[model samples]
Target: MSIQMEDCLLSYKTALMAVGAAAAYYIIRWFLWQLTVGDYDRKYVFVTGCDSGFGKLLAKRLDSLGFHVFAGCLTEKGVTDLQTGSSGRFKAILLDVTKSEDIAMAVKIVKENIPPGTGLWSLVNNAGISGPLGFPDCFTRKHYEQVLDVNMYGVIDMTNAFLPLLREANGRIINVASVLGRISIRTCIPYTISKHAVEAYSDGLRRSLRSQKVSVHILEPGLFKTELFNLDLIMKNIYKDFDAAPAETQEYYGRKCLKDFTWVVKLMGFASSQFHKVVNSHVHAITAKYPKYRYLVGYDAHCYFWPLMYLPEWISDFCLDIEFVPPAGAQKKKNN
Candidate 1:
């Protein structure tokens, strides 16, 4: 009986030791993580797409909080707006996201601007384009090429060019990927594909930078009230392009297709809101002591869309089809 008791005691002690070791390991890890990423007062942040939307708002917010903000815009008008709106705290640079020379110039400017010791604290890849939305079949090769060039290649080029500055500061890199990256929709195939590629690239970058103490974060935002979906702009483009389509193209799809497209556009406009959920999440990720790997911003992003990310592909497709189908009584009438 004594021998059995000794054996039992030994097993209990071993289990206790294991638990204690695990607890100690976690405590040390948490402490180190906290120490590595804490505080951001006077750090420099470089952000792209500062002309409008989340990028513009985040740049303004960070600048107001005393961070040196380098705002990259594509147009002269955007540069003017950022310069006039943000006082002297934010420096606006004309950066065409698709241009390699522009990205190189931006990196050069950053290297020259910061003093010898100070380094880039955060590099936010927020510049993106929402390409022409329709059935995937409708998109030409040129459309896919254009979208990928702006969304995926542009991000890779910028990151590769500015990696030195990011490493010097042990900075965090934030890429604005969308929920569409996780869950693909019927339309917006090119945009969706580009976002998925961004997620993969960001993940690889995070792994690569782990040893260097540089963190990478991906921001997945839901639909928001941005100029990307401006009704006037969309209508203008649609009419301009519709007129240029082959004469038979309009005869087949007819006015009904146009109406259906318009309805979809209006639905998107209604669903989108002006809330700053995405920008707020961006700020938190950039400024937090312990930044999370992925941030799902906006109500629909976290609530409606992200949950579907775990569903089976077939099931998810069926659900999406049901959600997007026109009403039962609204079917198009056959022409006699």
Candidate 2:
């Protein structure tokens, strides 16, 4: 053979080998991804924050798949509506996660329905609030408390209450943490703290519960439209929280803070409207033979937020904060 022909054959062989290797890896992964689910038809799943958003949709998703679903909703209206819409495979419990009595009642409700051995299949912590928005000083300690109560403490209280049932079934706990949980953002301190705490708590729970065979997974999804992202509610809260501050505080921050804050809200105008991505992750975490420890859903989550999370602190700070312009008051102060 001529020298060029030999070289061409060698290159073709290398490319073929790479393709074969890639195809084999994906096939193995596909097998592992198959549902090795237990008797879901008989098993029970308790999902909180099902009154709306991802939780509501997930409860429906699991119900359709044959699991006896226990949905925890925060309001009578939500409960009534969810029940009316579902196929009678799922039951709704009035669960205000901040209330200990409510949590106890939810536990009792789920336990009473199933036989002793069936036990709970999954606990999805999906209820959360956006809380009041502003620079940290614009809100009070009470404001922070309210956000933590639902987003962070609610998850803890609910998990602790249901751990025994999950242990009995050797099931799964899927906690919904966000990209914000991994990396702090411009505002949203209380939310960031709560989610970060959740990430830490989930890590600890996963390690400790391994011997019990209760797998724990964390779902981190980027911006998506839900009540949490409702623009009217967001803008209303912004004015309500920030406007209520003392005159001095408002002047210090200036009118421009409000403008920039609204800008941030508007930026979310393009956030994904689909909730299926997160719900699908929830389903996999429950049914897959060996589910992932962390599922990063959405393009924004995988392409941007994940990488930004690992950047060095100084670099991220500059990228996220320093280059950005300050509010009008801060700018004036700098000049003076």
Model 1 whole-model lDDT (C-alpha atoms): 0.81
Candidate 1, residues 1-336, lDDT tens digits: the string is: 699999999999999999999999999766754543434455889999888988888888888887888999989998888889675657899998899899989998888878776789999999999876764445678878998998899899988888888888888899989999888887578889999999999999999999998899999988887877777776665655555566566555556666666666667777567547888778877877787799887788878798788888887778777635442224444332
Report the Cα lDDT for candidate 2.
0.87
Q: Assess candidate 1 and give its TM-score to the true structure.
A: 0.81
Worst 10 residues of 1 by lDDT: 327-336
| lDDT scores of the candidates, listed in order | 0.81, 0.87
Question: What lDDT score goes with residue 192 in model 1?
Answer: 94
Residue-level lDDT tens digits of model 2 in 209-232: 999989889999898988887788
Q: By lDDT, who's the top model here?
A: 2
Cα TM-score per model: 0.81, 0.90
Q: Which stretches of candidate 2 lie over 4 Å from their true place?
A: 1-26, 322-324
